[model samples]
Target: MQGSGGPRKTLPELLSELDTMLGLAPVKQRVRAMVAEMDIDRKRRAAGMKTAERSRHLVFTGNPGTAKTTVARLLAQIYRELGVVSSGHVVEAQRSDLVAEFLGQTAPKTRAVCESAIGGILFIDEAYTLTEGDYAAEAVAELLTQMENRRDDLVVIVAGYPKEMDEFMEANPGLRSRFANRVEFPDYSNEELAGIFRIMARGQGYELAEDLETALPQRITRIPRGRGFANGRSARQLLEATITRQSGRLATMGDIAPEALNLLVANDLPAPEDSGVQQGDGGARRSLAELMAELDGMIGLAPVKDQVRTLVAETRVDARRRSAGLKVAARSRHLVFTGNPGTAKTTVARLIAQLFRELGVLSSGHLVETSRPDLIGEYIGTTAPKTRAVIEKAIGGVLFIDEAYTLVGDSPSDYGPEAVAELLVQMENRRDDLLVIAAGYPADMDRFLDANSGLRSRFGATVTFPDYSDEELAGIFEIMARSQNYLLSHDLRQALPAAIAGIDRTVGFANGRSARQLLERTIARQAVRLAAPDVDLDALPDEELQTLHVGDLPVA
Candidate 1:
C-alpha cells in the first residue's frame, strides 16, 4: 500500500551496499535474484493473480566468519522493499536466547523472539545447538508451529554446520517441509579468503609488499591440501592473528607508511618460533642415521618419529637411484601431517625441508609456513597478486599451511574460492620444485578435499596425528621441566598425571599441546612467586628456583 517502500529502491540500495563490502559477489547475486523474483511476484499478485506468496525461508550451513549474518541483514532490507513485510528489521538469536532452563519456558522465549522478528527476517545462528537437549527440542517444535501459522508475516533462517543442520532438520519432520528453500553457504575457497583479507587490510589502509603478493597465494593453495579440520573459519583466525602482529609492529615504528597502511608485508607474517630450541646449521646437513639419533633425544613424539623415519627412508632410496643415473619419477609433492599441536608439525616441516635440500629435490628447501591470511589480499582484484607472492616464496622449498581447510568458507561467493583457483595452477606448475603440506582436524580436511577435486588428486599422502595419552602428556611435562632446569618434586610428579588426565577429560582440552601450556603457566606462576617483595631473591636458596611442587601448578 505504501508503494513497496518508495518504488522498491531498497533492493538496489542493498546491492549497492554489498558491492562495496568486498568478496561477496556470489551472495550478492543470489540475494539480488531472490529480491527481484519476490518483487515481480508481488506486482503480479497486486495486478490480480489468485496466488500471492510470502517471503521464502533460507538455511545457511557453514562455519563462522563466512558472512552469514551480514547477508541475513541485507536480505531483510530486500524483503521489505519487495512488499513482503512492513519493517525491514533483522533480529538475530542463538540457542541461548531461545532455550530456557525450565519446561514450557522455551516456547514463550522462542515465541517472543519470533514476535519481535515479525514483518522481518529472524536469523538463528548455530541453530543445531538448540536441538541438543529436550528443552531445545521443545523450543524448536514450538518455533516450527509459529512458522506455519505466521508464514505470511515473517521470514525465518536457520544456520549451522552442514552435518548438524541435517540432523536438526531430521529431528523435526514438519521443519523440513516448512523450510523448503535451502541455500548452502559453502566455505570460501583460498582466493575468496585472500579477497576478504585484502578487503580488511584496505579498510585499515595497509598496502602489501609486491614480493608478499606473489608468495601469498601459493601459501593459500597449500592450506587445505591434506588435513580436514580447517576451513574458512581458520582463514578468519589467520587474519585476526596477522592483524594483531601488524598492530604490535606498528606501535613500535611510530608511523606506518601511507601506501603500506592498507597492506600486509612479508615481515608482518613471521614463521612461528620455538623457545630454547636451536637446530644448528650442521643439523640440516646430517644424514638420516644422524637425524634419527638426534630425534631420539627429543621426548614424547614416538608416533611422529616413526612415521618420519619411514618417509625419510623411502626418500633416501629414491634420491640414491636418481644420483646413480637411474631415472626415477618424482614423488608426489603433497603430504598430510596429521597431529594435534605440540606434536611438532612445524619442526617436522623444517626437518623435511633440510632433508630435501640434502637430496637435491629442491634448490634451497626453505620452509614457508602460512595460514589463510597470508594468501588473502584486501581488495577485489588484489587477491591474485597477494596469493601469487606467497607461492613465489615457497617456490624453491616446502610450504606448510597450518589448519589448511580454512581456505574455504560458508558461502560459494566467498573470495576464498578464487584464491584456490589461482593456487591450483601454481601447485601444478611448481610440482617438481615445491612440496606442500597441509594439516588440520580430520573431518574438516575431508570436507575440504570433497569441495575441490584437484586438491584430492594432488594430495597423495594423509598422516594422522593422534592426541597424546595422559601418560605421554606426563612424560612431555617432565621433559619440558627438565629442559627449563626445573625439577618436579616427588609429589608433583605423582600429581602431574592426574592433573593432565583431568584436563584431557574436558572438551577441547585433550590435545598434547595442552600439557605444554600447563607446564609453561606453572613456570610463570613460580617465577611470579619468586619475584615477590616478601621473598628476597638474594636470600632464597638456588634449590627453591630449581624445585617445583604441586602447589606451583594450577589445579585442573
Candidate 2:
C-alpha cells in the first residue's frame, strides 16, 4: 500500500502487472473475479442496501517459487485500495514462528503475529506444519478464533505444497470452511521459464548471446521438473551462477570492454554440477573433481578452501590404506567453524555438505540452518525432546548450528544446558550419518567447548575464517555491482577503496556485510540520478541505463 492517498498506479494498471506474470492464467482470471466482486460489493454498500457477508481468507496451493508470496503482496495492496482492509500490510510467518515446544506459549506467539496484521493480511507459509502436533494445533485454534472475531478487518492466507495443504485443510475441521477462497498456482513451462530468464537478464543489464537464445531454452526444457524444480526461480539461479562463472572466466583476461562485460556467451553457462544446479539428481553423484572445482570457483575464503582440500586429501589417502587391509580411523564428520559476521561460514558449511555428499560421505547435502533458540524450550522438562526433534530432521545431511555457544546460558536453571546435553547424545549416536557444524565467535565457541568435555574429541577439526582484506572488499563490491548489471566507472574503482578504508575497521567492521551495504547505497544513489523527474522510460538507452558513475559512490 504505497502512496495511500497520493497518485499511484490505478487498479487496472496493477491488474495489468498481474497479467504479465509468467504462468497461472487461471489464477489471474480468479484474481480478476475477486476484484470484480469487491467492486460490486462496494457499489451495494454505497446504495444503502444490505450486503452479503464474504470471507477474504484464501488458501494458495503451489510448489516452491511459483510466486504465491509475490501475488499475496500484490493482493494486500489491492485490498487496501478497494477498502477491504485498513493498512493493507502483509505479515509472513513460517512454522517456527507460530509453533512452540512448550504448552501455553504457542497461542501468544501466533496471536502476536496476527496482531501485527490487524488491518492487513497474515500469510502463513507452509501452513501444513500447523497440523503436525498438539502445539501447532493450539496455534491453529488461536488463528481460527482470531479470524472469527476480526472477519472484516483481517485477512488470512495459508500456503503450502498442494497435497500437504489439502491434507492439512481436511484434517482440521474448521480450516477448509474458513479458507474457501482458494487459488492454485501452476509451475511455468520451459518456454515460460526461458522468457523469465531473458526478463531477469535484461533487468540485470545483461543480454544472452545469440547462441544462448536457442541453447538456454533447450537446456531449460531438458531439466526435469520433479521434486525441487522451482520454475522461474530455477532459471534465475542459473543466470546468477552463469554470470559468476563468466566473471571467473574473464578474471585472467585484461582490458575488458564495457560492451563485452554485458554480453554473456554460451561459454559462460556453467556446467550442471559446478552451478549447484540439480537436474533431478542423477543416480551417480557428482565426481570429486567437479566438487573441488566448484569450491575453487567461490570468491573468497582461501583458508576454508585450503582446509577442505587438505581434508579431502587425507580422506583419500586413508581410503587407499584401508583398501590394503591396514587399520585406519574414521574421518570425523563434526566441525567447529568460528568467525565474525559476513565471513561466509554458512556458505562454506553448505559447500562442505555438498562436497561430502559428492564423495559418498552423506546421503544428501541439504544444509539445515538453525540456532540454539530453535533447539531450546521455555519449560524445564521440554527442551530435550525439542532438541531431539531438531536433530531428527537433519539425519542424512549437515546440521549447521550457527551461534551454537548461545546454548550455554549464564543462568543456572537455563534450559539451554538440557538442549546441549540432548544434542551431545545425538551427535555421538548418529555420528556415522549426520555431520554437525557448530559456528560462532572464536572465543565463545572455545568456551562452549571447554564447558562440554566430550565435544572436544568429537568435533576435532576447527576451521577459522579470516576477515576480508581491503582489496578483497573492493573486489566483492565490484562483483556485486557487475552481478546487478552495473559496471563501475574508473573513478569509483579508486573512490570505493578509499571509502572502504575509512569504514573504521575497529569494532563493527562487517567485511562482506559492509561491501553489500556500500553497493546498495551506490545503487540507490544511481537510481536517484537516472530516475530524475525529466527522464522517460521509453527514452532511456542501454548505455546510460547500465553505467554506474563515480558520482554514485559515497563521499569519502
How does model 1 score by TM-score? 0.49
Candidate 1 weakest lDDT stretch, 10 residues: 273-282
- Sequence-dependent TM-score of model 2: 0.51
Cα lDDT tens digits, model 2, 1-556, are: 1222223456887788898888778799999999999989999999987778888999997767789988987888788888898877788888998888898999998888888888888989999988887798899999999999888889999998765776688667998788889897866665677788899999999988987775675455443343355767888888888899889878989999888889998888866555544543323456788879978987778999999899888767765675555798876779999999888898888777767665545545667889978888778766875777667556546889999999988899889889888888877765644789999999999988887777788796999999988888888888888898888887877677788787767787778888898889888888898888987956889877888888998675
User: How many residue pairs clash (N, CA or C atoms closer than 3 angstroms) in each of the candidate models, in the order given?
Assistant: 60, 0
Q: Summarize candidate 1's per-residue lDDT along 279-346 as a digit string, tens digits.
A: 22213355656656766666567777787777777777876775465787656758877665667677
Q: Would you estimate the TM-scores of all the predictions?
A: 0.49, 0.51
Candidate 1 residue-pair clash tally: 60
